[model samples]
Every structure is written in C-alpha cells, then in structure tokens.
Target: MAALITRTRARWFAVAAAAVTLPRAAALTARASALTRRSMLLGAGTGALAAATSAAPALARPAPSDGAWAKHDGAFAGVEFDGFKKTPSGLEYKVFEEGYGVKPTAGQGIKAHYAGYLLDGAKFDSSYDRRSPLGFAVGTGRVIKGWDEALLDMRVGEKRVLKIPAALAYGKRGVGPIPADSTLVFFVELVAITG
Candidate 1:
C-alpha cells in the first residue's frame, strides 16, 4: 500500500510540472511572433518613406533655355507691324488709345484690365473673364518685366498692346497653358491709378 501511494504522488507532480511549463513555452512563442511582426511593419514603413522621397523631384525653378532669344524672335515675326516701338529691354508696345489722367509712378498702385495670349494666339489668362481688374504697384516687380516697364508710363483709361519677349515674360519655362520658350502678348487697359 505504501509503494502504490508514492508512485501515484510522483505521477501527479510530473503532470503538474508539464502543465505549467507548456503554458510558459506557448507564451514565449507568442511574444516572439509579435516582435517579429512589429519589426516587419517598421521596416516596411521606412522603405515606403525612402521610396516616396526618391520618386518625387525637388521643387526648384527650372533653368532658362539657351535658345530663348531665337524663340522670341521667331514669335515676334507674327506680329511685326508699324507703330510698334521697342524698349531698350526688348519689350514692344503700341498705345492704341491715350488717356489724360495721372500716370502711375514707380511705387504707385494702378488698376488695369488685361488679356494674356501666347504667340500662337491661345488665350492663357484674362481679368475680363472674372469681371475683375488687376491692381498692382507699377515698376515694383509685382508683375512681369514687360508690365512693370509699360505700366509706369501708362495713364488711367489708356489702352495698349504689349508684345513681351520670353525673358521679359515668363522666361524659358512658361507657366500653365504657356509652352516653354514662349513669347506673350497682352492687351492692357489702365482703368485707374489707385495709389
């Protein structure tokens, strides 16, 4: 009877030890799997960030083309006419209607209505469409070089047509709807000198 009880107690202790050890081993395995999943996710996130930065180009102004002058001259040929006078900086203009009101000075503000077009006659922008006139300081670099130079000498109610060279307009890389190396034309009406 004593040998039977000792054998039964030894069997019970072995079964209890196995039950405790099995649960601990399973917990360790689950912890290791969770760590591995976290590492994979972190690595994937870093790779995606690197790929996104490499795929996008840096934001910077494009360099002007060497053939800007040649392109401007070719575009100018289409509108070559008498009475158009060229400024020292290659801006061509013709005042179709003169105004008697005060002309805007360099720092003075002016209101104007304008329509912009490309050399091929495609309209790019216009203040008339929006029923709003543009207002800016004259010769303050608030606008393109051509507008700055022309507006300083313009008076209120004056209407002029400007043929802007590429350098005086949007340069080699033009804005939306205007192609690279394009020359611009504008029919500008000086509505008022606000300042």
Candidate 2:
C-alpha cells in the first residue's frame, strides 16, 4: 500500500508539472507571435515612408515637354505680328493695343483675361464672366510656346485673338474640355503683368 501511494503521488506531480509547463509555453508562443507581427507592420510602414520621401522631388518636377511649341523658321519658334510689341530681348512682348499675347520666360507669372475655344469655335475656358484676369506663370510649362510668344508683346489692357498650333498647345495630352493635338484659339486680354 505504501509503494502504490508513492507511485500515485509521483504520477500526479508529473501531470501537474506538465499542465503548468504547457500554459507557460503557450504564453511564450503568443508573445513571440505578437512581436513578429509588430515587427512586420513597422517594417512595412517604414518602407512606405521611405518611398514617398524619395519620390517627392520627382513629383514636383515639371516636364520639359509640358507646354507645346510650334515649329516655325526651322525651330520650335513662334511669330508675332501687328499689335504685338517685342521687348529689347526680342523674346518678350509688351502690348500697346488690342490683340493677342503670349507669356515667355519659362516661369513668369501673367494676369490676363482669356477666352479659349477649339479651332472649330467650340468654347472651352473663359474668365470674362468672372470679371477677373487669369493669372499664370510663363514657361514653368503652364502655357504652350504660342501663348508665351503672344503674351510677350502684349501690354496692360490689350486684347487680341490667338491661333495656337497643336505643337504649342496641348500636344497629345489635351486638358479638360480640350482635345489632344487640336489647334486652339484664344481671345486674350492682358490685365496685368506681375511676373
């Protein structure tokens, strides 16, 4: 009887030991899994942050071909006519009468009233109704070459119609309400020149 009791006690102790160890092992495994999951999430978040930081400059940079220019005189050039006054640099415009103008210098700002339409007379953009001049920068590739040339010779209070070639306008990627590579016609009024 004594030997049997000793054996039974030993078996119970072994069973109790196993039960306690099993819970401890389970807790350790849960902790490890949680740590692993946290590490993965942190790594993914860091990678995303790095990618965005690296790409910011590229996103801010403007494209060279953003604004189209007409091919004239064997160069991607533009022409100016009557009502168009050329500046001393022969690359700028200061209008003294009613006519069209283009903005030059890849990044000068312009304040003008404008009426834009398709060559077929389909109207697209207009600022006259707002009784406000539209402000835009030159060559920062906002406007095409034709517009740059046209604005160069225009002055405050000058208005004119402009015929823009496809090469100097939207090119293949036309903007809202404008077709790709379609010639544009604009009636421009120079209200101010702050750039």
TM-score for each of the candidates: 0.59, 0.45
lDDT of 2 by residue, 1-195 (tens): 999999999998877666555455445334323332122222433344334334332212211110111111221113333333333333322221232234344466777777676745567776765556678985465667777777765655454556676777778997888989887766666666576
- All models: lDDT? 0.64, 0.52
Name the Cα RMSD for model 1: 29.7
Q: What is candidate 2's CA lDDT for residue 16? A: 62
* Candidate with best TM-score: 1
How far out, in Å, is residue 1 in model 1?
99
Model 1: lowest-lDDT 10 consecutive positions: 60-69
Best by lDDT: 1
Model 1, residue 111: C-alpha shift (Å): 0.6
TM-score of 1: 0.59
Q: Write the per-residue lDDT of candidate 1 for residues 1-195, one digit (tens) a residue.
A: 999999999998877666555455445333323332122222433344334333323321112112111112123334243457899999988764455556788988888888787776567787776667888888889898999998888877666778888899888885888887777878777878787
